[model samples]
Target: MAKSLKSPPADLTRISTRNGGTFPLARISKVISGEAQLPGGHGNREMPVWGPFFSRVDADQDLGRMRVDSLARYLRKIQQP
Candidate 1:
């Protein structure tokens, strides 16, 4: 996944991370739903706010093709406000 300097869509619910990473929750939902893909190969310079910087792919893979109904609630509990 090449990091996009381009702006993300307006309607997305984005979770901003350190080092210029913004993971749109809806887009990630799409990824998990098979409506999209988030392939590996982008480096650790940036990553979805979900996991440790070095292994974001593993985190994403763990959520693959599965619907996690409480993603926002889960993320909210774990992540800083």
Candidate 2:
């Protein structure tokens, strides 16, 4: 399909913000492919999101979960006066 000037791209092309996260491209891909979700969250309830946050943890933990609360905590951690 040709590029449409009426709406945004169906698949993410770039990430304008990382929200203190890493690998912007990979994150975008996960969301675009609808593979982003919590360990036991709702099924088939995924939606394209912006400015995602991620955590790097142990092997037994959720090493690559995309969640908004993660972003919330990060924002609070780096809040400015």
The candidate maximizing lDDT is: 1
For candidate 1, the TM-score is 0.31
Per-residue error at 59 for model 1, in Å? 28
TM-score for all models, in order of appearance:
0.31, 0.25
lDDT of 2 by residue, 1-81 (tens): 335333333322122333343334444445533456522345444344432323323342353354433543444455432
Q: Where does model 2 exceed 4 Å of error?
A: 1-18, 21-23, 38-81
Candidate 2 pairs with clashing backbones: none
Q: What is the C-alpha RMSD of each candidate to the true structure, in Å?
A: 10.5, 11.6
**Worst 10-residue stretch by lDDT in candidate 1?**
45-54
How many Å off is the CA of 18 in candidate 1? 6.4
Q: Which ten residues in a row have the lowest lDDT in candidate 2?
A: 10-19
Model 2 TM-score, all chains together: 0.25
- Alpha-carbon runs more than 4 Å astray in model 1: 1-15, 18-21, 41-67
